[model samples]
Target: MKLDSAGLQVLSPAECVELLASTPIGRVVFTDHALPAVQPVNFVLDGTTVVMRTTPGSKLAVAARNTVVAFETDEFDPETGTGWSVTAIGYARAVTDPVETERLAHLSGAPWSPDGNDRFIVMPIRQVSGRRVRVRP
Candidate 1:
């Protein structure tokens, strides 16, 4: 797919959701210590939110200080020369509500972290977009 001058390719919401569900890992982008940082995170897609776990006092904790964030995931088959990427722009927050946390705990697949693994971080999606790429032979 080719991006327009603004470096964006319009994609349907359903397409974005589909891409998000197909991948178990994504990159979370945020600002930390006055600089931008990105972290690889294992996440589960919960309809409109992406959930992951991170340790306390981590860069993620500092970057997601009640601020907007970007999360992205993609799948590529180099042998088949096809792939798709999806990105979600949303607000990042810690899961503090007991009810919500309890419900999210039931989601399949747990996040892996070297730090304390009990803390959960969630990104509630506000906007999503994606694009598919096909390599020319």
Candidate 2:
């Protein structure tokens, strides 16, 4: 990673994926009413894909299907002023196959806040980028 943008280091794709796997919670950015919407979700990294649960008839279930979305996660230290941020943009779709859903079930785990989470959605990470900011001591 090389420093850029005010002491920010650009992370490699592998590094970005590693950081994503380390975190359980992330935000999904999608479209709502033709406008942008963001929602926090608990997700798991299945290889290079992101799998999460959503309820039927929910905004996520409806809006996210067959669409492009941006997922992101980050960790920051105020005192040390050091942290990393990762962003992934890709196509999202609902898991329709029962067998595939069962396979993914082993990886997704339980949702953070359950609300009839009967639907499973998957997002294939198409483009990923990350940055780390390290403040001087």
Candidate 3:
């Protein structure tokens, strides 16, 4: 297995994409008001693109538009001390086509919150990398 400098198992792009598809929630990092910000979002991977729903004109919707951002998701077991993290960096764009929006809405389902999150932001997985930590046997 490939290992990074820190001894963590280096994951391939396919592995990273698989991990990303397995998780429903992730953090999106973007620049907000000239400062870095991270927000947890409910997302689904449509192919290699990360699709997230947000209300129109929301902070994330506004700030992430046509900008490069990072999306990350991971899972860990406390007792085993084993985990894997996947991150995807790419440019984000708001889905504007009506047909595409309708298609994505079905895939996305309802928002995590009660608010109506009608806007869909799509980020194609341009660059992906991941690492896994496994406890010694």
TM-score: which candidate is best?
3
lDDT of 2 at 134: 68
Please name the candidate that would achieve the greatest lDDT relative to the true structure. Answer: 3
TM-score of model 2 vs. true structure: 0.86
- Give the lDDT of residue 125 in candidate 1: 93
Q: Flag regions of model 1 displaced more than 4 Å.
A: 1-10, 111-116, 134-137
The stretch of ten residues in a row with the least summed lDDT in candidate 1 is 108-117
lDDT of 3 by residue, 1-137 (tens): 99999999999999999999998999999999999999988899999999988778689888988999999998888888899999999999988776688788888885343244478899999999999977533
In model 2, the Cα lDDT at residue 41 comes to 82
- The per-model lDDT (C-alpha) reads 0.77, 0.86, 0.89
Give the alpha carbon lDDT tens digit for every residue of 18-103 in model 2.
99999999999999999999998878999999987777778888899899999999988888979989999999999887667767
Off by over 4 Å in 2: 5-7, 111-116, 134-137
Clashing pairs in 1: none
